[model samples]
Target: MARIIHRLYNERAFRRERVIRDRSNPLDIYNDEELIERFRFCRRDLFELIEELTPDLEFVSDRNAALPPSLQLLIALRFYANGAFQNTVGDMVCVHRSTACRVIRRVSLALSRRLARYVHLPNEAEAAAMKQQFRQASGIHGIVGCIDGTHVQIQAPSENEYLYVNRKGYHSVNVQIACDANYKIINLVARWPGSTHDSRILRESALLQDFEEGRCNGLLLGDSGYPLKRWLMTPLVAPTTDQERRYNTIHSATRSVVERCIGVLKRRFYCLHGEMRMHPERVCTVIAACTVLHNICISKRIPLPRHHQPLPVPEEDVRPRPAVGIEDIAGRLVRAQIINQL
Candidate 1:
């Protein structure tokens, strides 16, 4: 009898904790600003996302009524916008913490259904315009995008843990991102371990095939950590002449587009900025989902969250001797042409 009474008391408390004071949706209590503040998206965009992900999120389960697609998206977005613990975010919506964790995974993989739509290489029409913009902005001709690798911090994995330790002495994933001048993520490669060199990631990527096979035209501006290909240009190791100095200046300005793109991406979704607690495979999916959403936010002209701004991209290598790109003869000729023009 005493144990039964104790159990009843705990059940009542749990029921009260799950109940919202006055609203059906906890989201209704917040204004548009608060909605954006908490979820990084207004109701309209959130609803659209809900509609797109509804099919993917639909299911038959005991938790169905409690975990609708919209609410699941809300929970996931809240997690992404603020890298708080699962239980903490779960508390905001009155769901159990375990439910929140499952919802985050579900919503993340659901978003994956639309991944290829938003993130893609520029088409023929986009390439011409992008090249013109790159030329006008930095006087760097025929440049369509900038490529760079940024380390997304992650919790130490149980398997092959040493592979994830980057040069910074932290476990991370080295994500390669290429973006057009308009701060759009045109291409991304997110599966490499942090210990892998940025140049190696590019070397093994299909993006190189795009350039090599003529599927994608226009030059790419990358840092010294990437090899200098005929279609990819890197900064000079040492600039002696005025022309070489001018080339490096313009190259950096052009490359800063991708850097700022990364800054905006991590700023919009704080999950990428901090140590994500999920498995690496799931974390990569979340990163892909974030990139898709990042492109959407850019397209919709959504304002950045307060205090969110582009970060200065740090160098990948901080050792006594920084790594430089492997020089290619044809690439050198192409880079010289641009410098001479400058």
Candidate 2:
């Protein structure tokens, strides 16, 4: 039986002859040149953007001694691109794990500081442009931006699990973000306790501080979870009339930009989809870094899904309507609720 088996294996190998040929067309190898050219073009723009967004650190006297800023940017991009851990990034970048960690932190801080200038709430002119764009795209006017909060999972701490556990039954941090109709993040505030309500988180955030101080003239669109306030609007709880129902539908459709942004953000960074491996304190920093990168991608006009279009705005009656006093009441209630919760 052993002899038969050996003969059978030998016969199979003999039947399958290996072929080596030098006659293959050399032109096939040239096909990669076009790909290389495209890659170079992409790299050129990406590198320049990274250089502009990454601040020069004076802490290290010899810039040449440290990793190249391009390499540092590559590390951060890899984090968002692949959502890999430090060790994996180190392996791919050919650096030590500790070095990878340090590089990421350095690059994160540098980009966050530099990119903050570009990723802020829109000014009057910019807001006006966005309004006009919304009018053109969705036919709705007076729309500024959408606001919402999402929970990011974090590792549970042995000392205080309650502070980290959210309503979703996970250890997380509540992150509130505001995005324009274009889906570009305008404002972001992370570091709230997971147990905190969305309304409470918004009340305590600096994102709302401008609106509170009457510095912002644009309105913020939100869901029912957010308390109503001047410069901030929420959908009506129940639509009693056709106009109210239509308004609520429009509100939901347009307000979906924030939710879409959050979804895209989570889909891009797998680490954010579930519990992060890092400590809780570091989670906020990571989140901020991710958001800054998100804004950077947006500024570059990276292609996204077509569903990301702003919700269509319905035509309104030209007649003047009575001013609703709900904004003040909502603001007061939100402030009081936040204080009580704290």
Candidate 3:
């Protein structure tokens, strides 16, 4: 009887010890000295966002490696940072392939939910403040924000070839974004089919609906690909010999803010530059998370590349009247004037 009791006690002690050891160990994945250090810095934003949004989410142990919440987040950011495959991530983190996938998916969902709070469309007061800032920065009065769509490459799905194929002959996802005059992302809409026209997507987006209902007041600057609307502005299409060329030049210069913003985003996050290998549904989530990350980095005053200097305007020269009818010229002038008023 004494021997049996001793054996039972030893077994219980052994199980408790094993549990304690498991709880304390973290799985280290990457040995890249710089990456490890950088990942440590990246955790703060994710941690704060998660804590603020989901106060109840806690790090719990599973049968596989019991990853801490912070470490789990680190894994996702690391995935974005390097754009590596799951097998590669598993090798780096010292986990199995399945474990790496699970970690990434869990972290992605958590971050997406937490980060959504930060990317909402601005209210009236907030929109007014943004307008004032834009007026001050760009000297463009009555400007609320700029809107544009960019294509992100993705792996082609065998089932829906046309839906995913873009004009560029690649599988892509269209991400439409709205930014304040100060070039901060105010809102993002990412669910449109890749082949959808930018103008059509904008019409269907909440931004257009809100503006139409007078819930929001701001003009979105867009390229000619978008239709001309009272709430949206596009540059005057070239209609004459000299004026047409000048308008084109000016339009390209002014519309460059959105282009620069997109460039900076893709440059900073290498994962976005190439085709995203993840499922189609997750593409939107990844884009949103990256935008949120961009905002966080901006708020933290992360250094970004300086805006390119605008090209010098060409010398004005009087040109002979075009053979086109006077009615055409007058119509073009009217359209240009309407755009200017907006």
Q: How much does candidate 3 score in TM-score?
A: 0.73
Candidate 2 local lDDT, residue 97: 77
lDDT of 3 at 340: 53
TM-score of every candidate relative to the true structure: 0.90, 0.73, 0.73
The clash number for model 3 is 2
Ranking by TM-score: 1, 3, 2
> Quick one: best lDDT, which candidate?
1
Model 1 local distance difference test score: 0.86
Clashes of each: 0, 0, 2
Q: Write the per-residue lDDT of candidate 1 for residues 108-186, one digit (tens) a residue.
A: 8877767789989999999999999999988877889999888999999999999999988999999999999889998
**Top-scoring candidate (TM-score):** 1
Per-residue lDDT over 233-270 for candidate 3, one digit per residue giving the tens place of the 0 to 100 score? 56654446565555455545555666777766676565
Task: List runs of model 1 lying over 4 Å from the truth.
Answer: 1-24, 61-64, 313-326
Question: Could you list the CA RMSD of all candidates, in the order they appear?
Answer: 3.7, 12.5, 9.0
Task: Report the lDDT of model 2 for residue 302.
Answer: 55
The candidates, ranked best first by lDDT, are 1, 2, 3
